[model samples]
Target chain A: GDSVTQTEGLVTLTEGLPVMLNCTYQTIYSNPFLFWYVQHLNESPRLLLKSFTDNKRTEHQGFHATLHKSSSSFHLQKSSAQLSDSALYYCAPSMNYGSSGNKLIFGIGTLLSVKP
Target chain B: GGIITQTPKFLIGQEGQKLTLKCQQNFNHDTMYWYRQDSGKGLRLIYYSITENDLQKGDLSEGYDASREKKSSFSLTVTSAQKNEMAVFLCASSRTGGAREQYFGPGTRLTVL
Candidate 1:
C-alpha cells in the first residue's frame, strides 16, 4: 500500500513571504509518481505539478517541488506568496500496479492562507 | 482536451437513504474513479474501474457500490446515507491504468440530514 503525508494542516503567511509546504510519501515500489493538486475556494482540484524523476525540480505556476528518492519527499515551495495562492494543497502519490490501475493516495492536505 | 462531468452539483438525502451519484467523461479514458472528500480528511478513493464492466473497491468502498456502465460513464451509490454526513464526491478519469495524471470533475456536494 502507498500513502502520503503532509506535516502541516494549516500554514499562514503574509503576502510576499516565502512559502513551503512539506510532503512525504511511503510506497513499496521504487518508482512512484508524486503530484501536487490545488483547490481554490469553491473550485475543483486541479493538478499543479507532478514528477516521476528523482531529484528533478518540477515547476508550475509559481510553485516548485523536487522529488527526492533518498528522502521520499516532494515538498512544495514558492519564493513569494500571493493572495491568490491561498488554497488547499494535496500531496498525492501514484504507484503503478500494471493492469490493476494506478491509484492515487492523497494526504490529509495543507491549507495555505495568505494575508495582506 | 476533454472534461469529466458529475451530475447534480448538490445532493441532500435523509439518513439511511440510498443515493446515487453519476459521472461522465469525454476524454475516452480507459479508467474512471470515485472519491469522497471531507474537510480535513483529504480525498479517499471510494471505487475505481479500469475498464467497462470492471470495478475495484478502494480503501473507503464500504457501504458504497459502483457500476461502470460504459467506458465513458461510472456511477456510485451510497448504500445508506449516514446522519450528519457532509462531503463532496469527485469523479476523475485517466488515459490508462498507468502513472498518468488524473482529470477531475467539478464534484457533487452531498449532505445528509
Candidate 2:
C-alpha cells in the first residue's frame, strides 16, 4: 500500500529559526505526486506545495519542498520560521487507482509551533 | 475561484444514532472525497466519488455511507455514532484527482454524546 510518513508529531521552534519537517513516502508506483498541506488554527487545510518530478524543489508562501525519488522523501523546509508558520502540516501523495479515481494519502500530521 | 461549503459546522449526536454531513463545491470538480481527521491521526479517507453516481470505498469506509448525487455535491452518513467520539470531517474536491491540488471545505466537527 502507498503511505506517507512524518516522523515528528510536533516541532517547536523560535521565531527566525530554521525549519525542517521530515516527510518520507512508500509507494510501488514509479512516479509519485507529493504534496504538503497546511492547516492553521480553525482553518481548513490548504496546499502549500507539491511536486512529481524527482529532485525538483517546489515552493510557495515562503515554504519549499523537494521531492527526491531515489530517497522517497519530500521534506518541507524554510530558512526562517515565523510566528505565522505555526500550523499542522500534512504530507500527502496522490495515488491513482485505475478507474476508481485518484486519491491523496495523507501522513500523520506534524504540528509546528513557533514562539516569539 | 470557487468555494467548498460544508453544512452544520458543528454537530452533536447521541451514541448509536445516525448522522449525515453535507458538502457542496462550486468548483464543479469531477471528483469529491470525504475524510475523517482525528488528533494526531491525520486525515483518513472515508469515501470518494469519481463522478456523479460513482462511489468508491476508501481505507476507513466501514462505518460510513457516501452519496454523490450530483457532481458538485457529496454527502457522508455515519451509520452509528459511538459514545465519546469526537473528530472533524473534511470534504475536498480536485479537478480530477490525479496530479491535482485538492480544495477543502471548512469541515464539520462531530461530537457523540
Candidate 3:
C-alpha cells in the first residue's frame, strides 16, 4: 500500500516570509501522481496542484510544488505567505490511470499559521 | 464551475444504528469517491464509483456500503455505528479517472454516541 508523509504537523510563518510544507511519499507503483490540497476552516479540501512528470513545477494560486521522483518528495512552496493562506494542507499520492480509480492516499494534514 | 453537495452538514447517531450520507454532484463527473477524515488526520478512502451502478471498495470500506444508483448521486451507509466514532465524511468527483484532480464537497461531520 502507498503512503504519504507530511513531516510538519504545524508551521508558523510571518506574513511576507516564504512558506514550505514538507511532503514525502513511499509507493511501489512506477507512475505516481503527487498532489497538494488546501482546506480552509470549515471548507472542503481542494486541489492546489498535481504533478505527474518528474521534476516539473506545478503552480496554482501563488503556490508551487515540484514532484521529485528521485527523492520521492513533492514539497509545497510559496515565495510569500499571506494571512489568508492559513489552512490545512495535505499531501497525496495516486497511481497512474484508472487502475485504482485514481484513489488518493493522503498524509496527516499540516496546519499553516500565517501571522501578521 | 461545479459543486458537490453533501446533505446534513452534521449528523448524530446512536451505537449500532445505521446511518446514511448522501452526496450530489452537478459536474456530471464519471468518478465519485467517499473519504473519511478523522480529527487532525489524513483522509481515508472508503468507496468509489466509476459510473452509475458501479461500486468499488477502497482501503477503508470495511464498515461502509456505497450506492451509485444515478450518475449525479452517490450515497454511503454505515452498517453499524460505533460509540465515540466521530469523523468527517467528504464527497468528491472527478471528470475523468486516473490522476485527475478531484473536486470536493463540504464534509458531513458524524458523531456516534
Predicted structure with the largest DockQ when compared to the true one: 2
lDDT by residue (B1-113, candidate 1, tens digit) is: 99999998999999999999999999999989999999988888999999999998889999999999999999999999999999999999987744578999999999999
Count of steric clashes across candidates, in order: 0, 0, 0
- Residue A5 displacement in candidate 2 (angstroms): 1.2
What TM-score would you give candidate 2 relative to the actual structure?
0.97
The candidates, ranked best first by DockQ, are 2, 1, 3
Q: For candidate 1, give the docking quality class from DockQ.
A: medium
User: How does each model score on TM-score?
Assistant: 0.97, 0.97, 0.92
Which 10 consecutive residues of model 1 chain B have the lowest summed lDDT? B94-103
The interface RMSD values of the models, given in order, are 1.1, 1.0, 1.6
* lDDT of every model, 2 decimals: 0.92, 0.92, 0.89
- Candidate 2 lDDT, B2-97, residue by residue in tens: 999998899999999999999999998999999999888889999999999999999999999999999989999999999999999999999774
Model 1: residues >4 Å from true position, as ranges? Answer: B97-99
Reproduced native contacts, each prediction: 0.76, 0.85, 0.79
Docking class of 3: medium
Cα RMSD over interface residues, candidate 1? 1.1
